[model samples]
Target chain A: MAVEIVMPKLGWTAEEATITEWTKKDGELVQRGEVYLLVEGDKSVNEIESFETAILRLLPDGPKVGETVKIGTLLGYFVQPGERAPFEAAQMMATQAQSAPSVTADAPSLSTVDPDPYAGRDKRGPKISPRALRVANELGVDWQKLTGSGTSGRIVEADVQAAAAAAVAAKVAVVQAPPAQPVAAQVIAPAPAPPIARATPAAGNATRKTIAQRMSQSAHTTAPVTLTTEVDASEVFKLREAIKGDAKRSGVSSVPSYNDIFAKLVALALQEHPALNASWTDEGVLQHAHTNIGMAVQTERGLLVPVLRNPAAKSLTVIATEAAQLVERARNGNISGDEMRSGTFTITNLGMYDVDGFTPIINLPECAILGLGRMVAKVVVIDEATEKTAIRKMMTLSLTFDHRVVDGAPAAQFLQRIKQFVEQPYLWLTR
Target chain B: MKELTYTVAAREALDEEMARDPRIFVMGEGIGKRGGNFNTTLGLYEKYGPTRLCDTPISERGFVGLAVGAAMSGSIPVIDFMMVDFILDAMGEIINQMAKMQYMSSGRLRMPMVLRGCIGIGGAAATHHSGSYYSIFSNIPGLRVIVPTTPADVKGMFRTALRGNDPVIMLEHKNLLSNKGPVPDGDYTTPFGQARIARAGKHVTAVGVALTVQKCLQAADQLAKQGIEVEVIDPRSTSPLDIATILQSVKKTGRLMIVDDAFEPCGFGAEVSAQVGTHGFDDLDAPIRRLSGAFAPTPYSPPLENEIVPSVERIAAALGELVKE
Candidate 1:
């Protein structure tokens, strides 16, 4: 028999839960009592365990990451040795709902998806039930011959039996070592004269699609301007060196990466310039107290900005250690979408890639974003009194602020404060 | 090149290999006169005569043991187990002796024997006869599992099997016996662990073996009309799977789905799915899908029997999901 893996009804008031990550993918065998998936409800992430040992079949178009699906939704199925999923019509509809852009369709962000038959999913891969497999094996059933009426065209046991009975009635294919496979081939290999096109870009995943919509919204709605400034990063570099040594002596286990500096110092600057740490909402400009700095990391999955909560309050080493773990989790695709949401501001560094300066769009709902460029040694005038020039470590900081909430002057003042903190790391401790 | 059925192509491979190697011999039930169960060895009996083509009693363990001993001695013996399902009759000899003897012998002895049979669910032959066990046989250490999808592929792979110096088990799909296609003339051998692209498309790479290959192609065709292109790959052999071919195809297509005529759990589809999931993950835009045989018994009733086999509609549906916007 098969077990129904439904969305858990966490609390009486909780209406839905979002599936964070499926620890075990579909078609993988899972043992009883083992956590096979993770779901988030009421801000708490829960590992969902399998009640029985079985082969898993996840609903293909089901709730993706960041999608908050209703409770009791058919998340997937777990079939023991040889059992078929017992999903009814309503549950089937819920599974097929993923066929529609489950993320963009309901988000109200993208109004109408381009109506190309090419836009949505088309019929190609078969979804055969366990009973269907054995029945096909028992009767030498050709899988391609039957169309499933099940959810997303899954081949139920009934469909297999109907296909076999229909074949027997057709007289073309019957019980035997398939008489003259030429006749059988007619049923199996339909006229595959040629293909339409061999190369089309696969549909973008849910996360990337969400990123696209949000970025588009941010670009379309916000009146943003970027202010660039070159600051002497010598003090920040020395600070990093001292911290690394202190971390080594204190057994801190984590010497913060250079990016962690932006998370730390930019967060401190936001605390002083509270106007910069605010969002331009429809109601009014909402200011925030906690300085949660989103740190963006690039991965093949996509660009993920995991929020480092209260970076200003936490020690540099603590922020660095947590940022490292969050980045790893984000890269490994296990970090929850919640970790990416609700940031007061964002700090992205392209210094490692040797990029000088590039304007960064504000992550939606956040008022400003700070982009850190590569720190390079350049000959510069240190003192005009003696006309002295020296080689100093310098980096370009590009801060894009929402003009709707803050004017150019305040934005520049915010940038200067960051520059001041960058030029002298000792000021933050003294303040 | 000559147009030939899967049966005749398999026979030609046997005939040509035996003519090339005088030490090769054939043994099975009704193979000498009645032309074996599926007619793959129809004419070899008359052409090679009794010594080279001998029909044995239905004692699977006895004849299989003899074939292994014969292989250990010198001659290359190609034995047939009427049905892969009936292989249970000689499980001890096949799983233990024939599969492990070479490893134990080290460099001293070799077992260049072949166990040929028809696999896959078909003919409403009930549970006992219609069985697809390629995934099970692939688990053994010393066996090279080769499953051919087309007449041309069967001709090429069977020759490759005949030439290899290991215990090669070649499975012929029951539904494809009469399927006809162009077979290349003269010395041709389809290399093992190399996948064949049955059909090419841009969207999804759907891999199938033997019977399912045809299903994938058919599904690909249906998807093409709908403007969703699906690339179909046939890893002609399973044990030494041509994962590179699959990976390259996936790298191009950005999505992968495997169709196995066997059961889903620990089936050919599951193993291949696991392999690509780990290695070709970054290249994929969608999660890997496996359209495997239902994990139920091969039932007696035709309707119930057909339920377990993955079909064209299912393949196209899986591709549809993979190609979804």
Candidate 2:
């Protein structure tokens, strides 16, 4: 018997997916667990593996590369060598006749005359109730290919409701994956001109679309307030230089970057002001128990934030090594969906681009985000009594918080603690 | 509030109405002096003399015809037929004269008569004694057919029946006569065309009448242990069937099952299933199912008789299957 292969449900909320590529050609003998195709759902590419060890028989009329299809749509069949696939002989006959072929030979037997007494009524198409059809239309579910669990194999309202719930779960999965773009690029990017009459905008890829949707959602849903503060980074920079010197002497390959040091310091500051590490919900504010900080990395595809779990509880060396790997995976498009979920706070640094004091959008659900500017040398007063000046390293920190979650004073106090940690590294690092 | 048996509660309603009205009287065999075969008129014979609690011979047809004439003459007659099966002899008087007197008289004369009977197949009551023919009376145009299950509903509905001018048929299930439930202390009347949600649930809606209502409640309890909640609805009256309440429950649960101890063909369940199918079609998540008594005569054997009607276990199992769909 030939085994039918269909588009699998990627996530609970994923109704359809676009086929990106097919690794296995027609008649290719593929083993179980071998990647045969790649499909994109909710801006993420997922590799689909063959479930049976059989010769692949790609259907001539099946969905092609770049074609989007609903979940459970039959793509092709896997048949044994020398075994005729389903619909093969019919297609050949239809081609010869150049007309619609009669279904006498392959038509399903009437349930009353069928030898299998326990089988349900063999209908030509899905048997759905009026209520189920209404609900399916309302939820935008393709119910034609679904098997009914109702009596006498009839689709009912409950089945449609379950499908709608699964689709919602898939949408939630996309929301929790990644968020936001590079601050410098966002500031410099020009708005597109209004289209002329009858002119259409160019359709972008799934990643770009997802980024646009999330960025717009964050902007519209949040009551944003950006607070910028100049931090004297002389001590924090010296602390990193000393660690780098020790690592070089000890032959340690991994050295903590400023972002990693800031991630640690921010986690400690968030611990003191726990409200900053919380999410706003209609029910109440959820104060996260662990400090999972998301580091925004700009990749070729789009912006991806890989969350580092409980950074406050980890050592600086571990955070540096893990952050390096996470950034590498995210840029290479190898980061799994799980790695980008459940972030309590986010940090997007534009220090490498020589940007200074740029506001960043808040990554929602999270209460606040920290944007770091480049550290540069500036003349500052060393002693107010003597009126003497000295060169010190200064970096601008922009904290964008959702005002609905925390007040201006509390958010400013949290930023003050972060500045205190940067000016005096011993305050938090010693603990 | 005070709790009373179904029989006692109904008797109290009749006794209270008889005391309030001098024109009201009861007629049945062995009821005047013997105080009714089911203790229906227990002490009413002494309070209201023999003229009021009048006894007649074993002639259902003769007295039923006389009650129709007496009702036309401004007297309210309460006829207590011991077994509902015996009323089959007086079907002509009930369906034609008693059900159409007020309508035929152009509202000039009133037919204020209450026909009470014991109906149900239990206690080994053979084919001759056991019968539930509420569906036949409900089909008549001018008759009000009430089949109350709980003691509270029986007492309350009985008051409404006596006060109304239309002829009413009150069929009390034999199995539910001794079942006890709380009744309101003072004078109260349960209006017709309203249903009671005996138990609230979300998974499946089970609409039952009379004995089936009690059985569905028991089945609901058993199904609750398995996390399968079943809502039970009792349409207290058969003629003025409260289909709105049943429809609302079906909308919430999305599934419906009608549990009836009467026969399946043209039975009360058939009526309810048709009404719900027409009015509440979109609310259904499954086929409207009817768990009714077998289409056979009442048997003499206890086990055979038990097999005809739906039991608690059968109702629970049917509800479990309906909920899965």
Candidate 3:
């Protein structure tokens, strides 16, 4: 008896579905409970598992990818070896190919299988067990994208354990990306650099494609506003000098960089001005509890922001140490997606290029981004009564916010607090 | 190598320890003069004299407490229970006082006592005489539980337990007393937490303690003939079980079977399966299988008793089903 695989009614209302992929070939040996093919309903894509163990024999009239068939229509059959095909040739050409994004609402979606099993899976994502699911969920592994190798091809607890080991391997792989040599190279080459062409067609690079899609998404959905302000950086320079001297006196090798100090101060300022530490949602605003700041680093691949979490709660030294490591890894291209995502706020510094604060785009879903410009010595009018003139350091701060989430005043207040910290970096150290 | 019965191996370990040290002694009901009901302490009574082999009345609680006191006073005492079923009578002395003595004394006092008992079902011993209580006792913090499956392990682990300065519960299976195997003439101690591979196979890893190890080896041997490779591991000591060996074997085999003489729930097999499931699940191809003594008390009928306890037939059949997956 050939077990008929019908087009299942995925939801109460959904009837006809398109057979998007065939996991097993027509004559492949198939086992019960093994995922055999994928069918797309209006609301969901269900991976169809075999109900009986037998050789899979697709009817010549079986539906193909992009062809929508009626509910209860036969998709394929599981037949005994040497069994004859019951149907003759039936090809219904696709009227239109409509491929929707497969990610499910609230729940994570899994594609059943393709003729090529690895076709739909993320090369970097891990397949794990149920307990491993909990472990990966805790350790932050995006599991649904992984292809499993467990019994009947389902992630098991051991797979999760292996995923943890795999996660370490992934991190080590990222770290092996050409080390700080590039960082040194970038610093040494002070040529009149042409702006890196953002729209140059790279042949078959998937990362560039993804970056284009993400940037388009941000630009499409966000109501972005850019605000720029110049702050007195004399106090910040003196604070950095004191920190460097104290660190040298104590035999500390790494002193807090200006970016590290700003990142820490911005996180704390965001904490005080909670309106900026949020995400845009249809239901309401998602007020994030922790201050995870993503610092944008230009990598060999593209611009990547490696997030350092809870920067507001961390000490200045800790922030400097962690931020330095994150930037180094980002540059090396060894940073995991888990480290790249989970950001509530972001900071991009072009101060290194002597950029006088260009309008950096908001890393969308996050409310705002703060851009730091190069600090330079300038003549300032001091002692207003005597009309005396003296030298003072100044830097530009550009804050880009999602205007829909926060109004001008709160955004301005958040930037002002950041400005106050920039003027008096020692105020944060005392706290 | 000398072929010795399990009983003779145990007696030899005690005799060797007693002769080597003046403070070493044996105390249990009907152990002296009669030389133990199972004859495991047969010649120890005569060799050590009445003072060293002081047999007590049928009072496990009192005798166990007195032995704990003897251990506290710098004597290495070996206390035997006529049957593991009666261990409940001395739970306070064994679990609370003796198990907690060293920690309570802040390491000042060392209770080097060995509470030896016979477990496992056969001979229609019924519920009272047949009980695998080591798993229950192994739960205590300060106590180390050991079960020897062969003459070699019996002799070796016995020597280790007798010499070490910690409370060790040595559970010898009643049915294995008459079984014999080759034992080395010289002194050798099998370290705790080290598992011995009795028969190596590739399809599944089977773990057993005490007599179940023998049964699993027999099963493994039979399975090998059927073209199914089964790896049999004997965790000579249960409490500090040789889980690493089991996990490694499972990593290779991806299938696991545990044969135990203890009841299924919370038994040594269950614990081993759990640890492997938590830590080695990635290596597992199928759910862990545990073949243990039935939850019911050992029936008085010999056939029924044999049916309840894990057997080679049951172990092989379980592995056969597992291999099919």
Candidate 4:
């Protein structure tokens, strides 16, 4: 028999956890209650234990320490050492087998039939087991007087015990009989499955709620001044690949996508252009001294901008790590609200979809929101004199700034700095 | 003294706090010789020694748990999770244990544990190591959550977290650690559960935290161009949320809009709306609205991720809906 190892809910909030360490080697024999692995959560670290003695079979080797292991993921297959276990076949059969027994037409009617058949239909009778009926024939407490508490409206031992106690309390003569009596069992019928209905309307309602809310606050209340520019993205893409490769070689699983580098560049650009790192406040232009950059993350659920704190101080490796984590949390619908708030400058990237550019709303109280699009190959004159058309990778940059806080010139300059950083990747790296 | 970034302000807070209190010490991964992942604890090792600025293995749960134990044993332990994203790696310790230990022990155990979490997304660390989760700690009963948007706030909040009796999760926005703000050299602590009226207005009220507050302030400035005046409130401490300050602002303005960078289905913005809807539902002239990150995981691609999160347009649009209502 194989016992399924499912993701344990370490905390009350969520079920998924990141596997940090695996204590046992694959195919090694393990005893019950032995520590198998260590899982990391939002709050604490927990050690998972084996409940059954078996051999371990871990798949997807070299699973990174911080990657999420979802609920119901098979951590490993349990099998006896030196013996082939047909756990897979059992699992398949279990899935195909009927969950509950079906009702047979030849069986007695469940709802309308009399609970007990020995007495007349008009006279209520106590339901008795085959053994209880024989015992009652000898002692004679009226079977009709005994009540039932069991399922299918049948009599149970507890009911008999209560009646006997009540008879004794009432000073009625007790009929002594053998203690062993057949107990009636309840027949449980399979529950009918509920009819399936479309979920489109509920989903549509949620979308409408979001749209209505966004339309009113984002469009009407704030004066959104969008600034657009095009930047060469060849270097940004190359740098990302290089970083990811280097990190992998070093045993540190770093997935620095192009967005991560853009975030870093924006953070640096905010340093150069402090005007863009501000939000318009009621107290008249509240200038933000620190540049907390927020990035837009697209998940199955909705759009979320998880801000990376103090990007200026961290290395590219650390930044890459943090960006992956935040985006993953956002996608999983597990990110907390605090992570979403407090972005001095926002970066929205739609590069992967191959879209050139689109206007993005400002993540208010921040002065500017940067929109990024797909990196495409474009013909450029390598040398003006030669007129040589060379294929160069390029992407569009759109900046939506709070006009009240940032003027068009500064906003353009912020985009210009972003462009320079992307083109000259080494400079951005140095910063 | 010198022009300092937000990270420097944090480092300064640590230095100053350590100099003032002999009982306070910092322990975390790469904090000693490496100066910390973000350099927020730079040079701290040399000044305080290994005992004070302790560095441990990549075991966040182990070290953070040790910090909680250390705190109850008479020492004030400041544990730094290299990144706020990584902090979730030890949520069990921070939330279930550190946050609830004192209360569970019926006040017999004094937990002076300060958790410094590096939060937010800017660098392209897709989905895992970026973004803020202050609400995660704030939602729990025993924890105090703080997100510092400015250099001054960083220093002030750090001071307050260190002195507080309960465990505090100090969320340090990663990108904000570098920009400079003036802070008093001596010592001063900003009280917890107080909202700073970053911007005052009469037409509408906007509430936010950390960088989102900055975004709301920006949205407010833009709204000013359209003859819309917005009052912006920043709750530095998320747990002991100052509902009074937020409600008062909403009552005076009659219009309320909440902008949060976190995902929107259920967030701090939702909490603000609930509080307003329940307390001053009649006083509100417009429907309370919240602008938050789209309900999704943060994407790695620039455009897709950008489209998914909350932006100025979204915040402004929500405010517009409220105004029209």
Clashes of each: 43, 3, 5, 108
Residue lDDT tens for model 3, B1-325: 9999999988888888888889998888888899888886887777878999898988889988999999999999988786877878999998899999999999999988898989888888888998888678777789889988888888899899888889999999987888999998897888988888888888888888888888888888888889999988888887787789988898778788888888888877778888999999766767788888889977999888888887788889988887654
Better of 2 and 3 by TM-score: 2
Q: Write the per-residue lDDT of candidate 2 for residues A121-216, one digit (tens) a residue.
A: 453368887678767755657677677887668888878888877765655445454443563246435587575586454433566766766677
Tens digit of per-residue lDDT, candidate 4, span B196-269: 89999987899877777877878888888998888999888888899999889876777788877777766788
Interface RMSD of each: 10.4, 1.9, 5.5, 30.1
- Model 1 C-alpha lDDT per residue in residues B190-279, reported as the tens digit of each score: 888888888888877888888888888888888889998888888889989888898899777766788888888878888888888788
Of models 1 and 4, which has the larger DockQ? 1
- In order, what lDDT does every prediction score? 0.80, 0.87, 0.80, 0.74
**Best lDDT among the predictions, by candidate number:** 2
lDDT of 4 by residue, A1-431 (tens): 44555567787777788887776766555678988788888867888888888867665443455678776676656765444335544553455445524546675655332334433244335554332332332233444567555443444334455665565433311111211122101111125657587556553354345434543444544678877777777777787777677777988777666777777878898899988887555435655646677888866666678999978778777888898889889888788877876667888888788877788887655667888888888987778988877888878888888787878888888788888888997887774
Clash-forming residue pairs, model 2: A12-A166, A13-A167, A13-A170
Better of 2 and 4 by DockQ: 2
For each candidate, give its TM-score against the true structure.
0.45, 0.57, 0.47, 0.43
Rank order (by lDDT, best first): 2, 1, 3, 4
DockQ of each two-chain model: 0.01, 0.30, 0.05, 0.00
The candidate, 1 or 4, that scores higher on lDDT is: 1
Quick one: best TM-score, which candidate? 2
> Candidate 1 docking category?
incorrect
Chain A superposition TM-score, candidate 4 = 0.51
Off by over 4 Å in 2: A1-96, A99-124, A150-152, A180-431
In model 4, the runs with Cα more than 4 Å from the true position are A1-431, B1-3
Candidate 1 has an lDDT of 0.80
Q: What does candidate 1's lDDT look like per residue over A49-154, in tens digits?
A: 8877787877776677678899999887887533435553355455556676456544665333323444223433466654455566456576656776654465
Computed on C-alpha atoms, the DockQ of candidate 1 is 0.01
